[model samples]
Target: MMFEPFQRLTSRTIVLSQENIDTDQIIPARFLTTTSKEGLGQSVFFDWRYNTEGRLRNDSPLDGFAPSEFEILVAGPNFGCGSSREHAPWALSDFGFRAVVSSDIADIFKSNALKNGLLPVEVDKKTHQQLMKTPGAEVTIDLESQTVRIGHDWQTVFEVEAFARRCLLDGVDPLGHLIKQLPTIEAYERRRDEL
Candidate 1:
């Protein structure tokens, strides 16, 4: 998992439907068994996003940028819908998505993102409307203050959970975070042993 706290970024983004989109749809059921997170990027949004040969054709909005290159996806409300699998964000972050902006996010998905150090930004309906209209608009996610800016024209402020914020800030992937705090943890263990 890649943890990028202050990612100064630009990209062409697509705003999509707010429906029962889930992990299976995000990366397809075929890839679910894979243990490594790297190649799952190719399968992202498989069923609805690509043709049988897995080619990104002109019909879809995401086609503007090559699948390997696209960085942002502005989605509708209730995104990350369906089963709670960490693989959803795994594919996204592995696929190089720095941030995902939506009207509302599923709680489990948000937590999964935090564990992997992916930024899931939630904005109100008005901001969602503006971003949806911003075809191929580039988005900037400033983790220091948790703000998302589209081009030089508009910006949106968001709220992330405080503990999650600290983890993201220091580039702490979940595993790395636990290991980094291990000294204190070890001390606690030693005290407990004494008890």
Candidate 2:
């Protein structure tokens, strides 16, 4: 069996209005030059979050929050709208973001997140804008119903790639998904090996 549908993600929300935020922005190319999740957190959106000297400053949009404290990222249209780097999801996951809510996402990026267990939910422009302004925008991603509720009245219907949704619902890794039929796999392997 795969991951039983997720219940909720309750944590601090990060607001990222700048759209077309690509993989490089999430984890710069320079950082991509390391494999450790160890320091990737510090480099997430390094260009936007820190200064030339690698110092954390308070003059940015994502101020007053750190990676460890934030779990939800509310971003603008076409968020994650750039290069198809798998490292992007790695950085987000290692940084501790359980999910991301955006107006839209690049096809590849969305797929990448799903494999890492990070949800990429789509809420239309109106809901996206509203979520941007919702102080703390506590987003509850209900996998059972495919709806995202931001407080009481603010609810939006979200969609994901069908296979990705199924993967999340079943908690099956890409290969584990195939291995889900272990009996069949074992039978086939035995037959082939015996030959």
Q: Write the per-residue lDDT of candidate 1 for residues 33-126, one digit (tens) a residue.
A: 8877667666677676677896766576655566545677788777787778888998887777767888888888888877776678899888
Q: lDDT per residue, candidate 2, 1-195, as tens digits? A: 455354566665778887788787887887776755464665677788788887887776556666666788888778787787778887887777878888888889888888888898888899888888874766677876888887778877887778777778777777865767899989999999999
Q: If candidate 1 were superposed on the true structure by all CA atoms, what would the RMSD be?
A: 3.3
Cα lDDT for residue 117, candidate 2: 83
Q: How far in Å is the alpha carbon of 99 misplaced in model 1? A: 0.6
Lowest lDDT block of 10, candidate 1 = 1-10
RMSD of 2: 4.0
Count clashing pairs, candidate 2. 4
